[model samples]
Target: MSIDITWGRGDGAASVSTVAELDATLDTISRAHTEHLPYCVTLIAPGRGEFPVMLDICIGHPERSFVYHVAADGSSAWGYQPDLEPGPPFTFDYAGSPTDAWPERTRVTDATARQAARQFLTSGGQRPPALTWETVE
Candidate 1:
């Protein structure tokens, strides 16, 4: 998941804001993923005001990935789910929909995921994989 940024690319191949916290969350959730929790949920931008963020989780239990859109307050909604298919992994409509789905997507790692959250909060409705979420919370 590579996003075209104009301000130049960042080092470590991750453009997120909080690396330590995101890593901690990922580490905590990775353990949960192997446990009974099939969903393997993790906190993307937890405990924020009415800003807006997105959470994408890839679980190994059922072998599926989920995308969620969370608002600034405390509201959340589904973004895109690929139906758990294995045929070349279809590209979900993350941008340019009647609904503001997650238009901006980040890498499927802890650092990138945090960067994605920051982008979502500051996106204000941008392009590609960033239109999946609306202003709910």
Candidate 2:
């Protein structure tokens, strides 16, 4: 979902003031190469026990594309990621959106991360009966 839509909950966990802080942290936690993984986070929400939700923007767009979902705090965030293409038709639904653009040789990357993000948001997490890791939501 669009982070600008403004999540109605979790306002206290944000410690970073800018997207840089959040992105840098995510970079460290992420095992994917910085070149391949361009998705950087901004705000953060640590759950009491479950994964935290993040609020962030894309490095290039700085507008429409922002992520808001229940993901693990740090780089291990469990969330969705769409195909990120450059120029025109810039929207969160596009940039950061997932596609079949990945390769079959990759083994060390966190392949399931994007799909996880998609499921969580669609289910309206932070509520009861969280989405399962298997279902498509």
Candidate 3:
């Protein structure tokens, strides 16, 4: 299955089928952030039925991300706290929205962030087993 990736204020999203392709696209997103454009990478994976699972990743110092199961009943979950300090929200620009934010409690190191992304991609959007998660909203 292919995953759709989007970043910055662009409406266009790239469809990638392999981990290598996802990594390359993530590299581009990281470079964009390095240039001071705070954009989050959003990944959409095909789920069971109508709605697809979504993973939004804000890759920066204390990278942050969350996964939404997107069930038919509209329930969702988040990437739970992984022993990180519950610091203030890290604000960023995401798809034309300047107020997009993620809490530091959901933060992880760069390596951990990459691993989470890989897990999501490889598992076809399943909540990553390598990371702690909690059902919310």
Candidate 4:
């Protein structure tokens, strides 16, 4: 299954079918300022219509980032947050704009984020089992 990965404002879109390609692409996209806007990337298994299942990652920093998943029909959306305890809110560049995730939406390490991305890609956009996902409010 091939997944289309689009970073920033869509200029870095590419399709990857294997884990290695995904890994390499992820590695390239994970770097800040790699693209015109080094904020986030959206992964989609195309041909599912306009609202396809999407896995998005905010890779503003190498060590910490955020993940979000959305169902095709738009019935559900989730954010990965391993820790639920309240903490300082995180602000990062998202699609070229500064966006903030709530304190409850804790940041995750790159390893954790990558694991979730891999799971999402392998499962064809299914909610990743590698991380704890809470419904987006």
- Give the alpha carbon lDDT tens digit for every residue of 1-137 in model 2: 22222211231122433345434434453333234433433443444445555433232222223333444433332222234322233222123443222221111123233322333334333321221211114
lDDT of 3 by residue, 1-137 (tens): 88888776674579999989988887877765674645667888865666667776665544454333343345566565467765456566667677645564354555666777788889887766666766774
Q: Write the per-residue lDDT of candidate 4 for residues 16-85, one digit (tens) a residue.
A: 9888999888887765464443366788875565678888876645446667888777655555555634
**Model 3, residue pairs in steric clash:** none
Model 4 segments more than 4 A misplaced: 32-38, 81-90
The TM-scores, one per candidate, come to 0.35, 0.26, 0.79, 0.79
Determine which window of 10 residues in candidate 4 has minimal summed lDDT: 78-87
Relative to the unseen true structure, what is the C-alpha lDDT of residue 4 in candidate 4, on a scale of 0 to 100?
89
lDDT score of model 4?
0.70
Q: Is candidate 1 or candidate 4 better by lDDT?
A: 4
Report clashes for each candidate as comma-separated counts. 22, 10, 0, 0
**Between prediction 2 and prediction 3, which has the larger lDDT?**
3
Better of 1 and 2 by TM-score: 1
Residue 12 in model 3: shift from native, Å?
A: 4.4
- Stretches of candidate 3 above 4 Å error? 62-73, 100-105
